[model samples]
Target: MTWKSLKTVLASLVAVALAACSPTPSSGPEATVTVFAAASLTDALTEIAADYERDEGTRVRLSFGASGAVARQVEAGAPADVVILADPIWMDRLAAAGRLDEQRFDLLANSLVVIAPVDAAASQDVFEALSGGGRLAIGTPESVPAGAYARTWLQATGRWKAVQDRLVFAADVRGVRAFVARHEAALGIVYRSDVVGQDAVRIVLEPPPEEQPAIVYPAAGAADGGAEGRALLDYLRTPRAAAIFRLHGFEPVA
Candidate 1:
């Protein structure tokens, strides 16, 4: 072969080898991560997810719903990459079920509060407000952590029985807020974080710190997650994410 023909044949061989070494379409860039977080975390996580997306150049698909409902979805094999919940028990359950990574930690803490409409003169006293008039709104004890905490506090204070009859249960903490905001209930018990930036409602009372049940959010990587999910999970532990949580009224785990 002539010198030019030899050079051309070598170049063609190199091109064929390089093509063979390339990854297939399925092995190319990673897909966006899908995260399931609690309803109360909607605002803060949305901001955090945006920052994560911008910084990592990986898209994020966030899903916010009641902790229990979201937990059930994850348990049932939903294609979630991360799970953050208002209730730790569900996280524990998810971890136990092999749906979540074994390593999980408390993301933040919150305090419970009693709230009343901005226009109403509701008493700060739980028993007085419940016994004196309209329905009391709280999350259903079986599902919502906020409601469970509220009930535990009322019982601890020896006030559950007196107010049980007047209690109006909702699906979750946010639902309780809706009831109070709409005037459908005279009083509501919610997380301190949930009441922030509310123009239609005012916090009436909070239990003494020593007496309050511990309210914490737990987060973990999903068992079915990939490198992108793991990276986002690490980002959530950074000071920036903690700052964003604090800005939204959450107390980062100390």
Candidate 2:
């Protein structure tokens, strides 16, 4: 080959090599924030995650279950970055175990409601509605946060002892809803968020504050996690998140 032609070919080859080495546009900022949260937070969290990804260019994967179950998962070394729980107890346990940072916030609050099968009569008296062998579904006391709240509510309302025999324990609030939907149970208690858009059952009663424990959802970041987790924790405290929470039937923590 002529020297000039050889030089030109080599220059083109070098240009191609250099072009290959240049960084292409990033596939957006890639991040995996594993959030273990209460199942009741599903709708709100999904919406918040979409908004967060749009602004932060990160992906959020959420796992929803009972708060106590999530705490156990974290305790077992699950690689969760953030935890949003339906109650403070589980969050406190993780913080006490040094799994989560001391910084935590009560993100939102919710109320309890008794749901009945679609054909059930709408009664003015909440407890009396469940009389005459009404099968009640609630979360198991050991692992479900909502079950604990329901029990507390029942006890405070003086119905726990009367209704104990009729109680059918479920693994989680979702399970309780499922049981209620299937007619395996005539009545069940679940978070207000869970009953929205549910056509199989009707919300028969909103538990009076005197009959229920106030439901609070708290969030915290992993103690040893990076900025992504902390950023999410901070973002959850923003007014934007509060608005979203309110939109999903939660009471904003202000």
Candidate 3:
């Protein structure tokens, strides 16, 4: 063949070989990671997952709810690749049942704060403010870590018995925020992050760390989710993810 002809033929073969070797364009990983996290982490974790998807080239699906509820679902065979819980107690339950892998870490910590309708005056503390006969909303002590922590704080402050008559229980921390936001309850206890951007409620009191159990968020891969699960767990340990958690009011796990 002439030189130009041979060059053209070689170029065509190279093009064909390139096409044969290249993998098909795809959206993400072959494996999908399903992360079950606490409802309080909704805002922060959503953004973090988006960043993780960008960084790792994987698709991450997040399920957020009360920590206790999430734990129960995972125990019942929910397809969770990773678990990020608001309370270590619920996580421990999963660990004891062997649902979560043994390589767990305390990812973050949070504190409880009392909020009141934004229109309300700021002079009143949580205790005296609730004395105004306003409904007091809290997470359900049975299934909500925030609610459980809030209850412990109140009882420690000697307000549980005194506030019993005015108390209202919500299924989750968001429920408590909703009640206060709508003015259905003048006051409620929720995560600081929950009330951060909300103009409908104002934080009135923050429970001292000594008044309640430290709100530690523990994370681990599910026993069945394998390498993809562990990859997600590892991603969360990165400083970028830790910064996001800190911005959302969580204390970074050292």
Candidate 4:
């Protein structure tokens, strides 16, 4: 071959070798943030995750369950990046275990309500509505925040002893809603957010402001979450996310 042609061929071979040795460009999301959240925040967070992924080019992996269950999972070293819980008690446990970053805050608030099957008559009085012999469903008070709040409200209203015999305990707030929706229980106590978009059950009683228990949702980034997890935690506090939470019947914390 001619000298000029040989030189060109050698240069082309060198370029091909370099290209083959270089790392392949990724076509997937820029990063992924795994979140463990309370069951009550399911719909709102799912909507917000879509917006975050589109705007930030990152993926959000969500796992929803009872606040206590997810908190215990994080403590057991489950690979979670962020945690959003319906109660502060569980968040405190995570913080004590050193599983969370310093960036923790109360993210949202909700109210407790008594729900009944859609066919049931509306009742304004919580105690009277639950006076029937039929079962009254609630979350398991020991592990579920919603249940604990329900129990507190019942006790405060002087109805705990009256309703104790008829109580049906569920694994989570969602389970309580399901019990009422499926007619497995005559009535159920759950978060206001849990009934949003649900047609099978309707709110029969909403505790007055004076009687309502303080319901707060706290969020934090896991120590392993690094920058991406912290970013997601911040995004959840934005105005856009607040609007979404409002649509789902939750009050976003300012």
Candidate 5:
């Protein structure tokens, strides 16, 4: 081959080698934030996650269950980036174990309610209905925060002992709502947020201040969570997310 032609061929070969060695361009910033959320937050978080995914190109993989159960899963080393719970007790436990990246804060607040199946007689008097000794559903007090609140309210109003025998305990607030919705229980106590879109039941009572216990949903980043997880936690506290929480009948805690 002529010298110039050979040199040209060698230059072409070098260009191809350099092209092969170059790193591929990144498609985009895509990540998945694994979140464990309380059952009551199902609707709101799912909606907010859609917005987040669209805006950040980050997928939020959510797992919803009872707050206590979800907390236990995290404690047991379940791979979780963020946790939003219905109560702060579990958050405290996580903090105690040094499992949180920072101090947790209240994400949302909710109120207790008494509900009855739609087909049942309208009983505005929850205390009177429970006093009648029919099955009354509530979350199990030992672990479920809502159940503990219901028990507290019952005791404060002097209704617990009178109706304790009639109590049909459930695993979570959603379970209590389900019991009332399916007509499996004559009455049930659950968070107001739990019954927002449910049509099978109607609110019978909104507990008076004296009977209503404080309800707060606390959230925090898992200790092992990376930057994406921290970003997801911050997003949850934004005004846009707060508005969504309000739409779901939950109050944002300042």
Candidate 6:
């Protein structure tokens, strides 16, 4: 081949190599949805997020904490697409502040239980357990829905004032469980769902229906979440997500 022909062939080979190294354009725009959720909903939401990512090809980012804390974060302008709170009061605060969209509803329900370390003597009597002269753990009522519900139960059973001096406050229900699991607190009040998969602690008592507070989890889309956020909110109410919530010991609201 002539020198000119050889140069032409080299140029073609260079073009092919560059084309091979260039990044291929994606078929669709990448989508990511952020969800701020209550601590009690952690395991269930995580599994649901994984399923959503797998089925919808949109990434789901989850942030879990006490319901009031999560609501405060949203109020402080956190970048969240969806918000799932353990109480409607927090959701109401968000709605009042215009942080949430019009799409909102009760998502799940739970029950309160008293738990103790696995090795501790199982006592179904709430008063007897507290009379043992050890600290009782519970979430902080100021910012944790679980704590508020626990307080309600205690008051309904006429034990709130009696146990005030023996209370150990935690930031969330998980923290309460951790305290009991480690034997730091002799007993703890937490949601039934928080005890799932936890071998270190066992529920000792579930407050009767009359003494139990109404526990509800409310979910909403953020005002700025737009279409992607709305889609995520809708997906959470589907049958697939409900099954996961049930598996985690939460009752999905119809």
**Over 4 Å off, model 6:** 1-24, 27-29, 124-126
Per-residue lDDT for 39 in model 3?
A: 96
lDDT of 2 by residue, 99-175 (tens): 99766888888889988888876666756755777789999877888899888888877788989889999988889
lDDT of 4 by residue, 1-254 (tens): 99999999999999999999999987765689999999888888999999999999889999999998999999999999999988899899899999998899998999999999999875555456555568999999888999999999999999899899999999999999988989999889999999999999998888899999999999998878878898888888888888999999999888
Model 5: per-residue Cα lDDT over 176-229, one tens digit each: 998988878899999998888889998888987766788989889999888888
Worst lDDT run of 10 residues, candidate 1, spans 123-132
lDDT of each: 0.87, 0.86, 0.87, 0.90, 0.87, 0.91
Tens-place lDDT per residue, model 3, 120-218, is 776745567666578999999899999998888888888888888999999889999999999899889888778766788899887765675777889
TM-score of each: 0.86, 0.87, 0.88, 0.89, 0.88, 0.89
- Model 1 agreement with the true structure over 73-104: per-residue lDDT tens digits: 99999999889999999888898899987657
How far out, in Å, is residue 169 in model 2?
Answer: 0.8
**lDDT (C-alpha) at residue 118 in model 4:** 95
Clashing pairs in 4: none
Predictions ranked by TM-score, top down? 6, 4, 3, 5, 2, 1
Clashes of 2: 0
Residue 26 lDDT, candidate 5, scale 0-100: 94
- Candidate 2 clash pair list: none
Model 3: lDDT to the true structure? 0.87
- Clashes found in each candidate (C-alpha, N, C closer than 3 A): 0, 0, 0, 0, 0, 0
The predicted structure with the larger lDDT, 2 or 6, is 6
Residue 199 lDDT, candidate 3, scale 0-100: 81
